[model samples]
Each structure stands twice: as C-alpha cells, then as structure tokens.
Target: MRGRFGVHGGQYVPETLMSELGQLAEAYEHYRGDPGFTTELDSLLAEYAGRPSRLWFAANLTADLGGAKVYLKREDLNHTGSHKINNVLGQCLLAKRLGKTRVIAETGAGQHGVATATAAALLGLECEIFMGLEDTERQALNVYRMELLGATVHPVTSGTQTLKDAVNETMREWTRRVADTHYVLGSVMGPHPFPTMVRDFQSVIGREARAQILEAEGELPAAVLACVGGGSNAIGIFHPFLADEGVALIGCEAAGRGIDTYETAATIATGSLGVFHGMKSYFCQDDHGQIAPVYSISAGLDYPGIGPEHAYLHDTGRATYVPVTDAEAVDAFEYLARTEGVIAAIESAHAIAHARKLVPTLDAADSVIICLSGRGDKDVAAIARYRGHTVKED
Candidate 1:
C-alpha cells in the first residue's frame, strides 16, 4: 500500500522528476500524519464540498429496466457539481501544507479544471490549468468558469491538441517549476504517489455508498458501477467494496464506436501495456506501440489510458471492465433525462448505460449502485451537436 500497486505505478518519470516526486511524497506523508490536515479536509467536505452525497433509489428507471433495483450515488450534487472537488480540495490543502504557493493541474474535459479552480479560490492558492486546445474550444464555458474563479488556463496546442498533450504540457510545467509549485493531477492515473493518494482522497464515494446502501436495504448491493476515464471516479466508488463477495465492481470504458477496431478509449477493454505520461498501464496504442488517437462523444472519456489501480483490478478480476459505446451512452443519457428529469454528464451516462443492461440481469430483489459523476450542463451542447440538434432548456 505504501508504494506502487504492483508495476502499474512508480516514479517512472525522467531523472529530473525523481526529486520532485520525492519531495511531494515526503510532504504528503508528513501531511497524512498531521491531524490538522485531516481536520481541515473533513471540515471542508462537511461544509463546502458536500460529503456523504446521497444514494437515491432510482425506482422508476429500475422499473423501466426490467424491475431490478438501481440506486444512484449523487456525486453530481457536490458543490462544483462533480466528484472532482473531493480530490481537488484534498490535494490543494496538501499543497498548502507542503508550503507550495501555487497549484497546477492537467484536465481533459474541464471538470477537473473547474474543480481545481474552485479549490484554489477557496484556499487562496494560485492555480493554473492546462487544457487541450480542442477541449478548450469545446468546453469554453468551463474555461470561463476557471478564469472567473481566479485560475489561469493554458491551452495545450501540442500533439493533436488533446488530453494526452495537455498532460505532457502540465508535467513539463511542473518539472520546470517544482520549487514552489505542486502538480495536483486530476485522476487516479499518473506516476507514484499520485495514483495512490488520489484514490485515498476519493474513497469517500465508496465509503458513502456502502453505508447508504446498507441503510436502505439492510445489505450491500449486488454490484457497483462507475465510468472509468482516468479512473478516479470509479476507484473512488469501488475501492471500499473490493472485499465484499456478493458485490461486483464494474468500470465502464468508453467505446466511442466499438472496442474491436476504432474510435474507442477502452483502455482495459482493448488496450495493451505501455507507458504514457509517466505511468505504465493499459493504454490504447497502435501496432508500433505509439499512443493512438482516442475519440468519444463525451470529452471526459476521450483519453488513451486509464488509472493504474484499474489496470490491476482488471487483471485480478476483482473488478470487471466493459466498454460502453458512445451511441449506447447517448441513448442512456436521453433515457435518464426523459425518465428521471436528471440530465447526466455523458461520462456519467456510461455508467448508466451499464445499469440499463445490468439491472435486467439481476433478480427483482437485487440492487446496484451507479456513480452519478457529474451534472450534464457542461455536456448539453456537445450532446446536442452530436445528436445533430439543439437541446432546449427545460
């Protein structure tokens, strides 16, 4: 638990990054031992980030899905309206405790950027977010949100102008300014302590899911599901349920078209082992072992690699990973919006897509929990454009 979870994690960065990770690891360990860190984080979650987000029974949706009970862990209801805040606050506070004056992060779809910006604003930490140029164009509202919250946004114009490029840019910046800056990676992926540390910070979802489900049903669920992008949201909700024999953890990867040939970011479903952005994990790579271009209707799921812990979980069969196609996710997104009046993030819709299939297979008495990772407002335009239409506000 102290080091890499097998080969999936380590300080595999350039020699220049060794001392940087070492400094961060030492500071993080020191903060972990400090009660003040715990107290501050706890108080923030209670008063600000909305700890213990509700687990609501989606009876209508379950009934529509052939009568198997389904519950939603409403992480979408959090302060910045996503599960990202939980990790952001923790890392930003840790950065402060480490005497870092500024915090920086790399983001794909801008959920992490908004969350990091919110944390920076709350703690008065100077913050910068690196976003792929394409994503900045698509998710302009999030860019505006970050700027409004006092965080500077840099567009990553390198390497196809996508998430991978953003990550590379952020790491380069971190390496150049490691003295008084901390890189708060926005996922359960990345090198060394980041994967482990982010998971610990995000364990609140699983912790809440377990208690809420038991309180509602007097027993744990048959399965728990979350969409795996960089895998933080999924791991956050799956880790606390790993030992339960009756409970299965399902991580849904994005199959933008299908996993077999093209247009997918199904890292564990179809990816091979490779190194990208400092960590060796399952990644979508071509025949030459070069990182392949990824596509997804959901900006958040359009990444080539998943988190290291997810790689381990997939291999051990402790968690099952299935690819959910963009078409399938879109269908589910519309279904949930129409049925429950809850418009879901397309990243979140991947989990809901799985639930649509999972519920029907379960007995009427069986129940499943889905992590509602974030709200859908940021996705409305993307979803509309993908559908070749506009979504009229309700």
Candidate 2:
C-alpha cells in the first residue's frame, strides 16, 4: 500500500529482497531530508552532473511546423550525455551513505550503465552493470565507455536478450549479494521507493523546465513530451506539471515497426495490465500471460513495460501515451538534424516525431516542450545502419 500508485506499484520482489527494499525505503526517507545529504547532492548536481540544463527555443522548427512554438529541454547537455546521470548520482550517493561497497544496475541502451559507472568511479564504489547481449552489440561504444569508467559490464543472454532480460539478471544479482551492494535501478520502474525515489531525482528536469518556460513565455506550455521506455524521462518532466491541468503530459512509446505487428514495444498501446519486474504495470504479454518479445530501433526504448506511475497516469487520464514507429522516429531524427542543427538521440526522436504531429494541431500562440533526453552521438552508427548505410567500425 505504501508504494501503490493506485494499485500499480508494490513489493512484488522475492521475500529475501523484502527486508533490503524496506531498509532502502527507510534510508531514502531519512537522507532525502538530511541537510548534509541535500547540500552535497545539490553541489554534485551543479558541479559534476551539470544541473540546470538549458531550455532552448527551436525557432526554425517552430516556424517550419507553423503552429505551436517548440522548446527543447536540453538534458542531452548533461554530463555523460543523458538524463540518466541525475538518478545515478542520487542513488550512488545514497548507497555510500548506506555503507554499500558496490553498486549494480540494469541498462538497455547503456546510457544508465555509463552514468552509473561514472558515479561509482566518482564515489569510489565498485560497479557492475547488466546489459542485454543484443543491446551490448547495438551499443558497443557505450560498453567501452562504461569499462573506461571502471565498471564490469555483464551481457545478459536470457529472455529475449533485451532490456527485460537485463532487469531480471540485475535483480537476481542483487538478491544474491544484498549485504554490501545496492542496485541502482535505471528507470522509474521497480518496487516501492524506486519509482518514487527515481522520480524525485529526475524531477529536476520538470522543475527547471517549468521555471525556464514561464520566464521565457510567461505561461506554461500546451504540452510536455518525452519518450517513454521505462518512462523515467517522461515522469521526470511530467511530475512537476501534474498540478497544472492546462499543461498536458504526453509520452511517446516505441512502435518498433507498428503497433499492429508483434515487433513493437509500445506498451501503452498494445500491452495489458500485468505484473512484471516487481511492479504491477502495463506489459506486452501474450495469451498465456508470458511476456512477449519486444523490439525498437532505439535500444533505449526497447523495454516491454512502462513505469508503474505511468500506468496510474494513463488510467487517470492525466497523461496520454502514443506510439511512434521506427520509420517515423528515424525520419524525425534526421529532420531535427537538418532543421534545428541538433542530432537528438533516436529515443528522443520518438517524442520529436509525435511533436511534429501534435504541434501542427495547436494554435500558433501555444507552446510545447520536448525533453531531448540524450545526445545522439551513441546512436549515429546504429541510425546509419537503420537507414541502409553501412557503418564500418575501426
């Protein structure tokens, strides 16, 4: 009940992990309010992780769309090149306070893994990362980056060999050695304090965006858009805007091919209510209740389930989730590069693709903020391959 977001989240973890989760929840509550912790965390965010990321007005794109003014919340500019760093720094610091000597995490596209390894190196903690074997291939550069930061990257080959499998292996690893280790779960999925805790850490996006947009436009935007894999970036920017009913929350899911096909990861579009990965949320599952294999061009958006709080938001009509196909996302990925001179991550292009659709319908006076979740440098080679170009690595 403590973790439930209208019955979507709970401690569906193993009994052996219950006590560890409880202790984590308790420690999070205490340290979150502790002045020393807050001060140190704030300083690290500003000095290390590059807090207060810019909110830039996309004048060229807005004029081309010819309707709503477009603004980009530039989380890509943060250290390590993604919004993942925010949550990793918070969790790794908390792990230190709890006297954990090691930190382990699950990652898909490897942004979270890179970020976690960075924080662990900074805080002097031993780090291990579990990534899907398939993703390790798609994101080989990130694997090297993580290793350079002193992390052991374990490629998981089980259960479709994707984000879902990575989570499973990380959870099992956590259960095996809970005493001296903390699991720095990458997204807002998972049990109890995690969804809530990760949201709080990532909410800096929304808080800064809200202030910046108001100062720039003198009013809240018509909508805030972010791509949802496990829904960390979406919830991060959506949380502070929840009370402002005028501001719409939109999450773009990866429709790998299309929602009509089995090869898609649009959980909100094609999934049903189910429990998986220690959270009761919408998941892509088959007739027998087994998790279905999911696909997305962007390795970051390949998860089969969304965060539990996102399920609550969808059920309550506080947010709208829509599917964006690989074709459409790739088009937007290239379009943004040509139009705005910005090379956005393929994961973020899903949101940009939807914004291209939505902004055309809104009035010219209206504005929309899209969370540019990460830099596209890691995705360029993969994106080139997706577009039928051969990428020769050195």
* Number of the predicted model whose lDDT against the real structure is largest: 2
Q: Which stretches of candidate 2 lie over 4 Å from their true place?
A: none
Query: Per-model C-alpha lDDT, please?
Result: 0.90, 0.96
Give the alpha carbon lDDT tens digit for every residue of 170-215 in model 2. 9999999999999999999999899999999999999999999999
Candidate 1 lDDT over residue span 237-313, tens digit each: 99999999779999999999998868888888778998887787899999999899988887888999999889988
TM-score, candidate 2, is: 0.99
Off by over 4 Å in 1: 391-394
